[model samples]
Target: MGIVLNQSLKNTVITYLGFGIGAINTLYLYPVFLGATYYAVTNYILSAANVIMPLFAIGMQNTLVKFYSQCKTEEERGRFLSFTVLFPFLLCIPIGIIGLFFFDDLVYFVSKKNPVVQTFIWLIPFTGLCMAYFEIFYAWARVHMHSVFGNFIKEVGLRLFSLFAIVGVYFNWISIVDFVYVTSGIYFLALIVTMLYAFKIKRPNFQFYIPANVKDILEYTFYIILSGSVANLLLDGDKLMLNQYLVIENIAYYSVATYIALVISVPSRAMHQIVYPITAKLMHENKYEELNALYKKTSINLQIVGGFVMLCIFVNISQLYEIVPKEYSGGIIVVFMIGLSKYFDLILGNNNAIIFNSKYYRTVLFLGLFLVLITIVLNRIFIPLYGIMGCAFATLLSITLYSLAKLLFVVKRMHLYPFTKETVTSLIVTAVLFLAFYFWEFPLYPLIGIALKSIILTAVYLYVNYKLVISKEINDIIDKMLLKFKLRS
Candidate 1:
């Protein structure tokens, strides 16, 4: 718990800092600097990049993480690392060749409905290539057990670059076309810097050698590539599909709301870095008692933390939207819908880590593809009818369904549940707080009103949760933070 807590705290702070910078860019700067259409284009490009990279990289990042520790020597590790660095080229070259032959068809498909996407459509793969390499190098660093610097580069450095670029736009020093190109270049810059650092941490000893377990590695990477693609599609396919059916500006509207909602999942994401390995260790040891305890604690603690975020966002959603451009303000529904989905996924704890680490992970191949299929089907069916709200609905539905299946699988196989008495308490308290504060708004400016409501919400929420002990772990964390503050003072 000590190591987990320390790293989780550091990650939480860094993640929030990144999100803070992103919030500035998404909610404030992009809205003002790029406006609705260009802003939508920016987000669209990135979302597409995320979806495309898994295919290009062929899941080498996850493969690296899985097999790197199994090696018994530096030579074995070096060969494995070298293979991960080089294997992606096999798939990448094919993708490039295909894109070359089908460029017009690809461009036509993307921009047939929304022509703005046509101009920067090719940037998607370029950005995807850069992002894929960034993750590869980031994994390179992580294999050396050095993730903090890479996390900073991923979470904070990239956003900081975007921030400066936005100011360039605001000052008319950067045209929209140039901005798009430079933004893609920023992703490549992150890849270059992170790759350099990865080498600095532990340089990959280049060998024109493939590991003996090339078959196993390829098998795992293939499964991972498909599963990873499905996951990313569920996350970003809405934006991609929206480009086909709706106006490009709608992506901007949806992106802002989705970004705000994404804040709810930060706690779960922060904890995942350390928790995944711990879960794997416990499972390997067949220690059900400890694993169950950790599962319940993480679920309840995430619930308490994620619920607080959801409460603040929902309670002050109206005021939050007030600060955004009026043209983009219609996505309030998207926020709640997507926010709830992310919250549900969070409260399931590390269900994913448990499943992925277990022998039953093969089931994910079927389940993952099903989820992706349904997501795309739903988006295709609904987006034209309900527009951005439809996309939100699709996301919420698919994610909740996916979470439920994971929960059921873990319980049926492992005979443990993530819920305890604290789960009920945390949920009840969250519901009450949301209902109580949602309709009660201050009669003042939006920003001030949001501040006032948030402060009140946090105080009362904390007091009640602490009294009920819905999550002693979170309370312990708060206590430690306060103690450190006092000691420093």
Candidate 2:
């Protein structure tokens, strides 16, 4: 437990630091240098690529994680990796052929009103293929418990490359069309680097196995594809829908707000990376008690961390928007709404991981499909009426319902609940801190206002936690750090 906590904390710090750099690049630098329309085009293209990548992947990224752990020998695992890599290319060719046939119609349908977006639609399939291979190789790396490098490449490396491309565009070294192509090229380069690293660690040997095991893999992959598609739709579908139904510049505004809100999920993302493998191993061994304890602890810790992040965003949202163009200030409401959705997701802890690794996974997929339909309907009804705010509302409603459904499913099927006294305490304290900082405005300068609000919020939240003693783990960590420093002195 101690080791998991320490490593989880360390990894969370690194992931968020990387995400912080990404936020700056997305929110401030991109908008400041490039206009909102250009920025929105970039976001829409990337989001489209992400939404398409899973189709080409054929769910191999997830299948690798589940099946790789089941293999008894390294050679078998290597063969599985080889198959996973080859499978995507096969799926991609047919999809690419179909895309080529419908390319003009699809572009016309999605971006008819905005020709700039239409111009960039060609980048989607190329970037999608690159993204598919990147995940396939990344999963191969994760199976070996080497996640840090792959994460670096996925999270930081690609963003850093795009940052440079933006610089090139700013300096007039390349036209906007070339800039977009360069962004797609970055993913291809990242895929190449990850593949080289994967082979260097364990060279894959291709073998044609009997189609018996392949059948089972395909069935699992089918369920995972449905599940993954719904999940992506829930996460990024709002932006895509906004791009289609609303104005193009609204996509930029919504994206900025979404970026701020999505930061609350960083802890969950980092924890899930470590938790998925651990949960899979535990479930394999029938270690339900250990899994239950992990569920509770992760929920509480994530809520605490995620709560603080949401607090920061909510408190400074006004000042944050003031830095951007006035047109983007409308995103303030979107940020608040989406921040709540992410916080709800955090409170569910490892519910998604547990269900995905359990026998009830198929049932979970059905629920996700239902939610996807709901998300689509809600977005359609609201986006036409309210634009970005409507999209935010749709997301908030869909995510809340989805999280609740998963929570109930876990409790009913597994006879385990993640809520505890600490959970209640954390929620109350967070709510009070949020209310206190949200309504009370300081008369200081903008920067000073943010600093003071942050300080006050942190002090109040920590004091409440200290008074209630909500987390013995956090106290122990603080004690250990102080002890080590004292001994060194």
Candidate 3:
């Protein structure tokens, strides 16, 4: 927990900083500089690429995390690392060949409804391959307990670069089309730097000497591919479906709402970087008691942090939307629905690491596949009727069911649950703060109002959570910061 706390805090700061930059881009720059159509096109290309990223890497990222620690010797570890790198190419090559052969057909199918996508269709796989390897190497860093630097690159570096590129567009240094290319290139740059850092951590010996558990490795990798696809599909499939059903421009609006909601998930994403490898280690060593304790600790702590983020977003959602283009304001409902779904998942803590590393992972994969099917079906049914809001409804419903299933599966199979009395306490705190501050907006500028409310909310929220001691870890962090401030003064 000490190492987890230290690294998780750093990652959280880094993740939020990234999201801060992303908010500026999504809310202001993309809409102001690129306008609706190109903004939609940029988002669509990235989402489409993200949906296929799991297939391209063939789950090597997760496979690396799950299996890397099992290697007894450095030579053995090197061999496994080598295996992670080369194995993905086996599938990638054949897929690339097929994609190239049918490139025209692929373009026609993807761009049939919205031809703006036709020109950018080629970037999807290119960007997907880059994203795939970046995760693979990023896992390489995580397995060695060197997640912060990789996370900085992932959470901060990528967005920072995109900021520069978007600014270039605004300055007439690059056209919108050039911005699209720069966006894909930024992903490529992320992959390269992550690979370099991963190598610096443990220079790969580049041996194909397969581990004795090659069979188990392959089987896990296969299941991971399917499971990873399900996870990615759940996140990005909405955008892809939007591209299919609505004019490509609507995706920009939906992206804005989703970005605002995405801030709520930052704690989970940050914690997962350090927590996944640790969770895998615990499961590997059969530390059931420790694992269960971790489960509860992460659950409550994330709920407190994520609940704060949710409150900030939901309470100020109207103001946040006010700052964005009027066309994007239609997504207010989208934020609440999607934000609620993310909050549910956030309170589950390291539930994903538990399931993915557990023996019952295969069973959960089936559940995930079912959830994906439900998502597609729900989107198909709802998109035509309600448009963007319907897509949000479909997503909210699909994710809730999926999250609930995973919770039940963990409870039933492992007898480990993330909830404690603190769970209810955290929720109550969030609910109270939301109700109190939501309708009490200040009669000031939207930005200033958001700032003032956030300050008041933060002070009050932290004081209550500290008084109740919802998470000792969190309370300790607060106490330490206060002590530092007092000493500095």
Considering every candidate listed, which one attains the maximal lDDT? 3
Segments in model 1 whose C-alpha atoms lie over 4 Å from true places: 1-9, 475-489
Per-residue lDDT of 334 in model 1: 94
Q: What's the CA error at residue 226 for candidate 2, in Å?
A: 1.6
Cα lDDT tens digits for candidate 1, 349-462: 888899988888988768988998889899999998999999999999988998899899889888989999888878889998888999879989998999999999999998
Decoy 2 TM-score against native: 0.91
Model 2 pairs whose backbones collide: none
Best by TM-score: 1
Tens-digit lDDT string for candidate 2 (1-489): 565565466566667767877887877777877778888888888888888777889999989987887777777776777788887787778887998898878988888767778777888888888998899888888777677778788878888888888788879998766776788889899999999898877787877443338888999899878977887778778888987787788888999999989888877887787888898998999999999998998899898889988998897888877777788899999999999999998988898889988988888889889999999999999999999999999999999999999999999999879999999889888887777788766777767888888988887877677667777776667568769889433
Runs in model 2 deviating more than 4 A are 1-14, 69-78, 204-212, 277-291, 441-445, 481-489
Which ranges of candidate 3 are over 4 A from the true structure?
1-10, 68-80, 140-146, 196-212, 270-294, 463-489
Model 2 is weakest, by summed lDDT over 10 consecutive residues, at 1-10
Q: Write the per-residue lDDT of candidate 3 for residues 288-376, one digit (tens) a residue.
A: 99999999999998899899989998999999788777888899999999999999999999999999888888888999899999999
Ranking by lDDT: 3, 1, 2
Q: Is candidate 1 or candidate 3 better by lDDT?
A: 3
TM-score of each: 0.94, 0.91, 0.89
